[model samples]
Target: MTTLLAASQTAALLPYPALAREIAALLADALVRVPARLVQALPGGASLFVMPAFDARLAIAKLITFTPANAGSGRPAIQGDVLVFDVASGARRLQLDGPTVTARRTAAVSLLAAQRLAPGNAGPLLVVGAGAQGRAHLEAFAQGLGIREVRIASRSAASASALAAHARTLGLQASVADDPERQLADCPLAVTCTPAAGVVLRGRLRDDAFVAAVGAFTPAMVELAPQLCRDVAARGTIVVDTPDAQHEAGDLLQAGLDVARLPDLRAVVLGPARPSPGPVLFKSCGWAGWDLAAARCAVDQLEQS
Candidate 1:
C-alpha cells in the first residue's frame, strides 16, 4: 500500500540538502524539458506537464493548480497530488503532496542555478520575499553556495525581520531590508522569490549582478522591472528553466526585451560549472520534472528510514 502523508509528516520526511544534491545531478543531464499544457479557469488555474527522460529514470506526469481564494481563506494556493510510477512497467509506486514536491524542487532548482550560475567567489545575496519559498531559497543557497551574507525583503518589515533573524541563527550574516532596491547596490547575486505582479528591482542594480527571477510564472505575474529585462537581454545572458515559458512571462514581454533566442538552464552549464560570461539572469518557472526528482529523493530517504 502507498503510505499516506500529511504536510507536517512529509515535511519531516523530506531532506532538503540531500535532495538538492540529487537535483543538481539531474539538472545537469542536458535533457530538454518535456512539454506542458495549461487549462485556465476564472477562479483557478491548472496545468498538466509530462516530464520524461530516457528509461523514465525520473518522470512526473501530473496536474497542478492554484486557487487564490482558497489560499486567502487559509487554504493552499497549490493543492494537488502526485502519482509516481515505475517507467518500466508503468507501475504506480508512491503518492505524495504535489505542493510539497513543488516547493522543494522549485527552491532546489533555483539554488542549483545560483550555485552553478554565480561567479566562483560570489558575494552578499539579496532575496526578495520572506515566505516559505524565500526561506527555502535562503537555506538551500546557503548550503549550496557557502554564502556569507543574506538580506531578505518582504512587503511587511516585521515578517522580513523575523525571517532574517531565523537565518542569522544559521550563521549567515542576515538582515532585513525595508527597501530592497537600496540593498541591491552592493549585492552580486539576487533571487526574486515573491509573487508580485509588478517589478521589484527596476532601477536598483550594479553593472555586474546575477539575478534569478523565480516569482513570475503565469502571463500576468511579474517580479522584475521592464528595464531589468532589457538590461539582461542586452548585456548579460538570461538563463531560464524553460524558454517557451519565459517568452510568455509578462515582465519580459512587457519590457519589449528581444533576444534573437532565449536559452534554457542547460545552456548555462559547461561540465557542471557556470560558463564564463558577463552578468547573468536565470528565470525559474516551476517545472514538473523537478518536483518528480525531489519526490523521488524524498521517497528514497523515507525507504531507508
Candidate 2:
C-alpha cells in the first residue's frame, strides 16, 4: 500500500523552528558527503531535475520541474513529488507533495540562513515577489526567524496586497511596498522570490544587510542586480546551499561573480556564524537532498503519530 501526502498535511508535519533546524542539520550532514543533482532542460523553457539523497537506513528521490510561465496561470512555477524508498530493499515507500515540499523546505532553508547571516538589528524584512515562495518565507520568518515586520512587493498589486494582509493575520506587521527600489535601501533582511527574466532587483542594499535570492535558477533569469552581488561580496561571503549553484544560480552568474568560489551553507549552518564586515547574501538553487531530508522527517513523524 502507498500513502499520499498532500500540501496541507506536509505543512502540518514541520512547524516553525523545527523545520528550519531540520533542513539546516540535513545540509550540515550532506557536507560530509554530497550527492550530485541532475538537471535537464525541456522544450519551451521548462526544466526537470532529479535529486537523490540517502543515509544508512533510508534513501529518497525527488523529481521536480521548473515552469517560469506558470506564475500567471494561478499554478506554481515549480512542482514535483518526493519518492521515499527502503534503503536495503530498494522498494518505494511513499509519495509526498512536491510543491508543498518545495515551498516549505525552500522557506526553511532561507530562514535558517537568515538566522545565521542577518544581524540582530535586522527588522521590517523585505520580500520581493508576492508568490508562493514569498508567502512561505513570510510564514517561516514570523514563526521562527524573529522577523515581525514585513514589506511585500510584486508586479501584481493584488498579489502583493493579499500576501501582506495574510501576513498581518499571522500577527506580523505587514505592508505592500509600492516602490520596491526605494524600500530596498532600508531593509537589513530581504528575500527575492521573483521569476524574473531580467534584473528585477536593483538599488543598493543596506550596509551589513542580508538578502536571500531564491529565484532565478536558470542562467537567463535574474532577480538580483550585479551591484547587489558585488556589494555583498565586498562586505561578507556569498553563501549557496549547494556547489551546483555555480552552474544553476543565474543571479550570481549574471553579476559576473565567481560562482565556483562561493562557500556553501554547509559550513555556515554546521558551525557558529561569525559577524561579517559588511552584508551577507545567500543564493539558493533548490537542492533535491533537502526534499529527501524533509520527506524523511515527515515520514518519521507520521509513523510516530
- Give the per-residue lDDT of model 2 (tens digit) for 1-305: 56777778778876657777777767656332337877898999788878887876567778889887786898777788888877778777778888888888889888888888776544788999898899998888888777789998899999999999999898888989987788877788888888766677778777668888998776777888888788778867789987888988988888899988888887787667565667788899887767766876787777879
TM-score of each: 0.85, 0.93
lDDT of 1 at 226: 82
lDDT values for all models: 0.70, 0.80
Off by over 4 Å in 1: 8-14, 27-33, 42-59, 70-73, 120-122, 270-273, 303-305
Task: Indicate which candidate wins on TM-score.
Answer: 2
Candidate 2's TM-score reads 0.93
- Residues forming the 10-long window of minimal summed lDDT in candidate 1: 46-55
Q: What C-alpha RMSD separates each model from the true structure?
A: 3.1, 2.0
